[model samples]
Structure formats: C-alpha cells, structure tokens
Target: MTAEKANNLLEQIARSKKEGRLPPVHDWHPPFCGDIDMVIKADGSWHYMGSPIGRERMVRLFSTVLRRDDDDYFLVTPVEKVGITVEDVPFVVTAVQVRDVEGAQVLEFTTSVGDTVVASAENPMRVELDPQTQEPRPYILIRDRLEARIHRNVFYELVEMAKPTLIDGVEWFGVESAGEFFRIAPVS
Candidate 1:
C-alpha cells in the first residue's frame, strides 16, 4: 500500500474512533486464506471472529516454525492467515494467542498476514482493533510475560529483579510485571 493510501485509511479510522464506530477487522480476500482475522481486547485477550478463546489454545493456534526474538516469538498459523481489509484498504494479519504459563495474563497479536518469514524486530507487524476498542484501548501491549520468556529462551536474555525499588514521590511508571499490576487504574 502506498503512503497516501495508508494515510487515508488511518484518517478513516480516526473518524470512526471519534464517531464511536467499531474498528474494522480485516476480512481476508481470495488468494490469502479461509479463516478471518482476530481482534485484541483491553485485557490482552483475543476474540476470534467474535468467539473468545482462552489464552492457552490461542497460543497454540500458531505452528512453531522457528523461534524469533523475545518481543516476537516467530510462528506459523495452524490455519490460513488472511488479508484484512479496513475502510477498503487491505493488510495481511494472522491470529495469535500467547499465555504466561505461570500467570493467567495473556498476549495476543493479530500480525500482518504474509508468508515472508522474518524475525520480530520491535513489532514485526501492526495489529488493528475492530475500530471500537481501537478508540479506547490505544496503548498496545508489546512486551508481556510470554514475550519475555521467548526472548530469554530463544532470542535474547533479560534479567529482572524479583522486586524493584521505586523512587518515592514518582507519580507512576509502567508495570514491572504482569501479575503485579492492574489493568484498570484507579481514577484519582
């Protein structure tokens, strides 16, 4: 997609968000695959074409091709990955579900659909919400417990202290770990 076209599509999404319309999901066109694209939620769980599945099976939805970096654990979809069309603009995305194994929290990636195998640098692809959540859930969860483990075991190693000493008087910082934080922050 050209930059001009991509910009127009983004503008449409902005308008939709303002109008309180649900973000569009990429419906795969022919030559891509059979299954539909997925959407992510505020809690980092996946809704499979309107059906919600637990984090474990969601992770298994992908067939392990090879391990990528910690940020992106490279894997192939068990089913056909599809090309998603939003506001008439199309992008490829695959459905993915990841779990912490030790924690109930999960990480979901609706990756760009394509057969071009590559390592996950930062985020290998862009994830889109069904327009509605995209408005409210603006903050994307890139690094999570599952991704941390993949980086440690397959890509790179990350060392974290069991406890982090905070600087007193600091208003807030990002969560130190998944289980240790709350999704909905208190309004003060």
Candidate 2:
C-alpha cells in the first residue's frame, strides 16, 4: 500500500476512535484490498515493509484498526480491508497489576498496545504447555477474539501469586481475579 493511503487509513481510524472509545472496525464490512507488507511479531513488535514500526503511537493507532475474521487478521476501515501477518498472537501482555475488588484479588493486564483488561469470567486466562519443551504459553483475552500472550516476567509474577484449587477432584495451581478462578497448571 502507498504511504498516502496508509496515512488515510490511520486518519480514518483516529477519527473513529475520537468519535467513540474504539475504532468501528468490527462494524465495517469493507472489501479486502489485498495484503500489506506488515507483520506483528510474537515479541509484540510491529514491522512494515521489512522495517520496524518504531513509533509507539503509530503502532497503537494501527492496532485500533486491527480485526480478526475467523483465523485471519486484517486492518479494516470503512472503505478498505487489508491483510497482515501475525507471528503468534497479536498483542503481548507487558505488565500486570493486582488489586482487591470487593474482597476479591483482581488481575489487571496491560498489553503492548496500551489496552488494559481485567481477567474475569468475560476475559479468562489460560496456559498451553509446549509438548517438547514443556514451556508455558500463557494468554489472557483482550477483546473480540483477540488475546495477549502473557510476557515472561508477568507470567513469573503470576506464578508467584498462584494458589492451589480443587478441580475435577484434582489439585491445580491457579490464580483468582474478579471472583473467578483461572487454572495456570495442573499439579503433577
């Protein structure tokens, strides 16, 4: 895509965000305008045309227009939709905060794109262990089928706060947030 058109897309997304709290990309049904040389790396870095998108603000702006349909990721506006490559998940959880809400310990996660989400029944957390290495791939839901992979440091913090809970007659290590219990790992 041309730089001018890209700027136009950014302007459109910015205007939509100003009008409401988020871009209306979900409500848009724009036709696919083919692929763009953009990539969201697993490390939560954005690249375009094989160059890193250094500006944090610009990356956040593009994230607002990002949408997922089924398994594919796209950048959408009222008039256009274009595909982009995602290495793993779109966002990465960079920080996590703990607070008590009505006597329940709440976990609030901050993503690379500046989205803050509280882990609850609506936005649960999960962990997937790698088969070969047994590495933990933890994630928390952000919004609209989008999730952020919990960063290593943040995951460690979560583990430090984990407690055992009974599930299916077995003890599992998990955390509590927003009155919801989320299993991090099954005790072996």
Candidate 3:
C-alpha cells in the first residue's frame, strides 16, 4: 500500500473509532480494530529501524498455510479470536508490494492452526502433540510492484514472527522483549 492510501486508511480507522464503529469487513481477514504497532530491525535483529503509528487501527496481519486452485486457500483467524486455527481463519488480500530487496513480496494470510496444544488422556495410550505439524501453510506468489506499506508494520510483524528469512532486507518480530519499542492506544 502507498503512503497516501495508508494514511487514508488510518483516517478512516480513526473516524470509525471516534464514532465507536468497527472496521468494515474485507476479503482478507475479518474487519478488526485495535492498537497495532510493529518494530522493524534493519540488520538481522540488530536494532529497530522504524515503526507504524495508528489509533484503534485495523489489524490486517495473517498467515497462509498452503494454496490450491483459485480460492481453495487456508489462513488463520483474526488476532482477536478465542482460539487460533485454520478454521478460525479468514481470507483477505487488501494490498501487495515488493520490497527494496530482490524477490517477490510475500503475502501473509491467517490460518486456523496456531499456538495451541491438545493432549490426549489415556492410561496406556497417552500421546504427545507436535507443534511444527500445526504451522499454517503458505501460498507463495509473484506479483508486480507492491502496495503502500501503510499496514507494513502489521504485515511486517506477522511475517517477522511467522515466516522465515527470505531476503536480507528488513525483518519483523513481535515486541515481546522489546516492550519499550511498541506503544498502543485504546479504541474509542
């Protein structure tokens, strides 16, 4: 997304928030509004490069497990769901972009399967679950150009934490340890 478009989106989100309204539902993830922030590291987790700013913003971050036909894709649920899974996932593709580095831009979709643990209880048939087996699938594609990095922070954070390093460009990760790196505000 371009800076202009992203700024417009932020304006729309701010308006919705001021009126106590929720974000409009889109093809990608279900309409979600919250305080979203991301810290980008410039040199492989060396330091913070920059971050995005918004109020009661729309969170568009997602993870895709795999791809099929034209629409037979799987993604994760919105960030606000009770339990994250492929079934809890939503489908959306608001914008696309290509970074300054080589290679095509990676699209992040939400899936139903995420950090969840299921244990089987039995006297002699106890079984443990594997976490990697539950990772969301990915749909790698090629698209020309890229969208405004408006939600770049959101997408950056998602890919940083979920997807692996593909290029030597900017990378994202959650603010778990860098608590001081992120700042959020309540929705109106």
Candidate 4:
C-alpha cells in the first residue's frame, strides 16, 4: 500500500473512533477495499509496512474498528473495510485479575489493546496443544468473535490457580470463573 493510502486508512479509522463512544464496527457494512500491509503479530504488536506501530493510542483506536468476517480480519468504517493479516489472535492477554464472587472465582483478563473481559460462559477460555511442539496455546474470547491469546506468564498464573475437577468420573484440571469451570488440561 502506498503511504498516501495507508495514511488515509489511518485517518478513516481514527475518525470512526472519534465519532462513536465505542466504535460500532459490527454495524458497519462497508465494502471490502482490499488488503492493507498492516499485520498483527503473535506477540500482540501491530506492524505497518514491516515496522512496529509504536503509538499505543493509535493501536487502541485501530483495535476499536477491527472486525472479523468468518476467518478474515478487517479494519472497518462506515465507508471502507480493509483487510489485515493476523499471525494468531489479534490481541494478547497481558494481565489478569482474580476475585471471588458469591463463592465463585471470577477472572478478568486485560488485553494489550486495553480491552478487559471477564471469563465466563460467554467469554470462555480454551487451550490448544501444538501437535509438534506440544506447547499450549491458550486463548479467551474478548468480544464479537475476536480472541486474545493468553501471555505465557499469565497462563502460568492461571495454571497455578487451577483446581482439579471430576467430570464424568475423570479428573480434569481447570480454572473457575463466573461459576463455570474451563478445563485447561486433563490429568495424565
């Protein structure tokens, strides 16, 4: 993408963020205007033209306008929907807060983009084990089908807090949030 076009895209998204209290990207049905060179790396960093987008405010603005249609991701406004590449999920859960609520532990995760979501039935946590490396790829739903991958340290914290539960007579290790138990792994 040309510098002019990239600047235009930024302006459009920034304008959209300014117009709405919270960007209603789900309501925007702009036409697909083709792909942008922006990429969201696995580490939750945004890159444009191969350089990291160091502006935290701008990144937060872009996150508001981000949308996912099926498997593809886009930055949408009332006028345009521009595609972007995502290595894993679009955000990373960098911090976590845990509290007890009515005998249940509620876990709230804060993403790198400044969005916080409490894990529940609606915002469930899931872990995918890599077949080759056997590494755990943990994620939690943020909103509207967008997910944030749990950072390594945060995941370790979760594991430390996990309790073993018996499901169907099988012992499984998991965490509790909002009265729901999300299985992280089954006992070997």
Task: Identify the leading candidate in terms of TM-score.
Answer: 2
Clash totals for all models, in order? 12, 0, 29, 0
Give the alpha-carbon lDDT of every model.
Answer: 0.30, 0.93, 0.25, 0.92
What tens-digit string does per-residue lDDT give for candidate 2 at 27-67?
A: 99989899999999999999999999999999998998889
Q: Which whole-number lDDT from 0 to 100 does residue 57 have in model 1? A: 31
Task: List CA RMSD, all candidates.
Answer: 16.7, 1.0, 20.3, 1.4
lDDT of 1: 0.30
Off by over 4 Å in 3: 24-128, 133-188
TM-score of each prediction: 0.23, 0.97, 0.21, 0.94
Off by over 4 Å in 4: none
lDDT of 1 by residue, 38-128 (tens): 4434333444456554655323322112122323322222222333212211122233344454654433434332222222333332222
Off by over 4 Å in 1: 1-31, 34-37, 63-80, 84-188
Off by over 4 Å in 2: none
* Candidate 4: residue 90 lDDT (0-100): 100
> Worst lDDT window (10 residues) for model 3?
117-126
**TM-score rank order:** 2, 4, 1, 3
Of 2 and 3, the candidate ahead on lDDT is 2
